[model samples]
Target chain A: MSETWKAFKPYALITPQTLVFLLFLVFPIVMIGVVSFWEFNGYSMTPAFTLANYQGIFTDVTLKTYLNTFKFLGLVWVATLLIGYPVAYFLAFHVPKLEWQILLFLVCTIPFWTSNIIRMISWVPLLGREGLVNQILMGIGLTQQPLEFLLYSDFAVVLGMVHLYIIFMIAPIFNSLMRIERSLITAAEDLGASGVQIFKEVILPLSAPGIAIGSIFIVTLVMGEFVTVRLMGGGQSASVGKLIQTQIGSLQYPLAAANAIVLLAVTMLIIVSILRVLDIRKEL
Target chain B: MQKRALSFYLLLAFFCLFVLFLYGPMITIFMLSLQGPDGALTFPMRGLSFYWLGQVFQEQRVGNFIEPFVRSLLLGATVMAITITASVLASMGFRQRFKGSTVIFYMTIASLIVPSILVSLGIGVVFQVMGWPTNWFSSGLGAHLTWTLPIAFLIMLGIFNRFDPSYEEAARDLGATDPKTFWEIVLPLIAPSLLGVGLLTFTLSYDEFTRTSLVSGQNNTLPLEIFGMTTNVTSPALYALGTLTTIFSASLILIAYFAYTAVVKRQRGKA
Candidate 1:
C-alpha cells in the first residue's frame, strides 16, 4: 500500500490541473482540428470528411489578409523594439538604485494589467478628427486640416498595437538586462570601449533571448489581432483574426477552424524558429 | 560622484515624454467622462459634471452594464479560486519529475500560445455540439481557465524553481510529517507568489475579451460589454464606463501589492 501510494502521489496531486488542461486546452484544440475536416452548411455542420474548408484558404482575399496581418506584425515588432529598448536600457543600467528601478518598472507595467479595450478606446479622444493631436497640429500651423490618417486607419491600428504591446517588450528586455553581470559592463568600459561599442558588443548580444521573447509576443498578438484592428482600424483594415471572426459570424465554423489551423501553423513556425535560437525555459 | 552626463538628462526628458505619451490619452478620456450633459467626445471642455458618468448606470440609455460588470467580478473570483488551488497542487507535484510531467509542461505552454479565437471557437463548437447550453460560467469559465491557468502555473514554476528546499528538509528531519512540513514550511514561504497568482488570474479573467466574446454565450463580460458600447455609443458615458473598470482593476492591483508586501515583511520578521 505504501509503495503504491508513493507511486501515485504526484499524479494524484496534479489531477485537478491536468483535468482542467485536458478538458479546456487539449480537448478544445483537438476538437478544432476535428471540426476543420467536417462539413458545414448554412444552419449546421455535419461530420462528413471534406477538404472544402481547407481549399477555401487559397482565395486572393485570404492571401491578401495574411499579407496585411504579417505587415502589421512586422511594423508593431519594429516599433515596440525601437521605442521600448531604450526605456528598458534606462531602467536596467541607468537607474541608480534597486527600489526605484522596481517602482518605476511597476509604473511601466501597471497599465498593462488594466482593461485592453479601455486602453484601445482611450486613443479616440486624442486621435479623432477634432481631437487633441489635431488641435495642437492646427494650432502650430503644421497642417490646416486634421490628418485623416490619425484615427480609424492603418496608422491608428499600428499606433494602438505599439501602445498595447510595448509592455511585453520592455518587461522581458528589462528582465534580461537585470540578469547581466554589472562587472562585465564595467570591464568593457575599463578596457577603453566607448559606450556605443560596449552596448553593441556586449549588451545587445546578451539581450537576444529577451528580444526573441518580446518579438514572439508582439508578432503573435498583432497577427491574431481582431479587437485591436476592429477598434483602432475602425473596420478599415483586414487581418487573419478578423477574417476568421467574420467566418464564424456567418456560421462558417469549418472554414474558421481551417483558418485557425493555418494561423496556428504560421505562428508556430515563427515561434519555433525563434526557439531554435534560444531555450525559453533556460532563460527564466 | 562624478558629474552626471548630458545623456542622463536627455534620457530623463525622453522618459518623461514617454510617460506622458503613455498616460495623456487615458487622462483625456477620464476627464472627458466627467463632461457635462452635452459634452462631445473630443475636447473644448463642455463644462465639468458627473452627468455623463451617471448616465452609464442608466441601462435604458446604454444597455445593461452593471450586470456584466458584477458578473465579470464573480467570474474572476471563481477562476481565482480554482487557479490558486490547482496551480499550487501542480507546482508541488512538479517538484519531482514524474510520469507525464513533460507532457503537462508543454501542454501548459501550448495553452498560452494557442490563439484566443481558437479556444473561443473550439469550446463554443464543442459545447454546442454536445447539446449543452454554453454559459458565462460553463464554457466561458473554461475558456478563461485556459488563459489564466497557464500564466499562474508558469509563475508558480518560477517561484518553485527558485525555492530553497533546505527548509522543508530541515522540517522533515525534525520529525515533522509531510503535511506538517508543507503547511509549516512551504506554504508560508510561497504565500507571496500565491498572492501574485491570485491577482493575475482575477485581473486576466476580468479583462479578457477575444476568448470570452464568442464563448460567453448569451451574456457579456465587462470587456465584452464595453466592446459592444464602442461601435454605436459615441458619448463620454463610454469613457465613464472605462474609467470605472480601470479604477476597479487598479485598486485590485494596489490591494494585491499591499498584501504581497505585508506577507514579505511578515516572513522577514519570522525569519
Candidate 2:
C-alpha cells in the first residue's frame, strides 16, 4: 500500500499539466505535421495527402519573400543588439543600487504594459504624412516633403520590435549582472584592474549567459515575427509569419502548417546551438 | 577627463532622444484621437470636440462595437484560468527530479521562443483538421491558451525554481499528507508567481493578434476588430478605440501589479 501510494503521488502531481500539454501543445504540433501534407481547395483543406503546398512555398515570389523575411530578421537582431547593449550596460553597471535598478527596469517595461497593437499603432500617427517626425523634419528643412519612407518601411518595423523587445534584453542582463558578486569586481580592482579592464575580463565573460538568453529570445522571436512585419512592412514584407497568416486567412492550412514546421525546425536548431554554447542548463 | 564628460553628455542625450523616439509617436496618436477630420490635426482656430469620441460610442457601426471588448475579456479570463492551472502543475512536475524532465523542460522553452505566427498557424491548422469547434467558448479559448501557456509556464517555473523545498519537507514531516503539504505550504510560497503569471497571461490573451487572427475564424477579439478597422477604414474612430483600449489595458496591468505586490508583501509578513 505504501509503495503504491508513493508511486501514485508523482503521477497524480504530473497528471493535470501533462494532460494539458498533450491536449494543447504536443498534440497540436503533431497535428500540424500531419495537416501540412493535405490538399487545400479554395475554402478548406481536403482529407488527402499532397506535396503541392510544400512545393508552392518554393516559388520565385515566395522565395523572394522568404529571403526578405530573413533579411528583416537579421536587421532587427543586429540593430536591437547594437542599441540594446549599451542601455543594458548602463543599467547593470552604471546604476548605483538595486532599488534604482529595479525602478529603471520598471520604466523600461511600462511601455510593454500596454497592448502591442496600441504600441505599434502609436507609430503610425507619429510617422504618418502629417505626423510629428515629418513636422520636425519639415521644420528643420531636412526634406522638401514629408518622408515617404517613414511609416510603411523596414525601419519602422525594426524600430517597433526593438522598442518592445529591449526590455527582454535588459531583464536578463540585469539578472546576470545582479548575480555577480560585488567582491569579484572589488577583487579585480584590488588587482589594479581599471573599469574597462574589469568589464572586458570579468563582467563581460560572466554576463555571457544573460547575453545568450537575450539573444536567443530576440533572434528567435524576430525570425518568427508577423505583427510588426505585417503592420510596419506594409503588406510588402512577406515574413514566414506573414506567409503563414496569409495561408491561414486564405484557407491554405496545409501550406501554413508546412511553413510553421520549417520555422519551428529553424528556431529549435538556433536554440539548441545557443544552448550548447551557453550551457544555460548548468546555470539553472 | 573631458572625453569622459563628453561621453556622459552624449549618453544622456542619446537616452533622452531614444525616450522621445520611443514614446513620441504614442503621444501624437493620443493627440490625434482628439482631433476631427479637417484642420483638427493642425493647430489654432478649431478647438477639440468630442466628435470622434462620440462617433466611436454612438454611431451604430462604431458605438455598438462592444462585442469585441466582451469577447476579449472573456478570452483573457479563460486563458488566465487555464494557464494558471497548467503552469502550476507543470512547475511542480518539473521541480521534481524525474526522468525526461530535461527534455520536457526544453520543449517548453522551445515554445517560448517560437514565433507567435508559426505556432498559431500550426495550431490553427491542427484544429481545423481535427474539426475543433471554433466557437467563442471553444476554439477561441483554446487559441488564447496556445499563446498564454508558454509564457505562464516559464514564469511559474522561474518562481518555483527559486522556492525553498524545505518548507514542503517540513510540512510533510509534521504529519501532513503530500497533497495537504502541497496545498497549504507549497502553494502559498508560489502564490506570488501565480499572480504574476495570471496578470501576464491575461494581458497577452487580451492583446493577442497573430494567433487569435488565425484560430479565431469568425470570432472578433479587440485586436481583430482593430485590424479590420485599420484595413477596412482608416478612420479616427479606430484611433479613439485604440486609445480607449490602451487605457483599459494599462489600468489592468497597474491593478494586477499592485494586487500581486500587496499579496506578496502580506505573505512575506506572515512568514
Per-residue accuracy of model 1 over B1-271 as CA lDDT, tens digit each: 2433767777777777778878878898899999898898899889899998788788646687889989998999999999999998898899887988998888887888777888888888788678898899999999999999888988888889999999988998899987898888899789897887799789999999988888888888889988988888977889988998898888888888878888888888998
Docking class of 1: medium
The TM-score that candidate 1 achieves is 0.96
lDDT of 1 by residue, A132-231 (tens): 9999999999999999999999889999989888999998899999999999988998899888888899999888889988888876777778988888
**lDDT, candidate 2, at B25:** 65
Give one digit per residue, the lDDT tens place, for model 2 in B1-271.
5755666666667656666766676666677778755424322213466667667666555335678789888878988887898778777777756666777776666566667676566666666766775655566676667667777777777787788888988887888987798789887777766777788788888887766666676768888878767665556677677778877777777777778888888977987
Model 1 chain B: ten consecutive residues of lowest lDDT: B1-10
lDDT (0 to 1) per candidate: 0.87, 0.74
Q: Which candidate achieves the best TM-score against the true structure?
A: 1
User: What is the per-residue lDDT of model 2 for residues A144-197, given as tens digits with 9 covering 90 to 100?
Assistant: 899987888878877878877777776787678778888999999899987689
Could you tell me the lDDT of residue A120 within candidate 2?
84
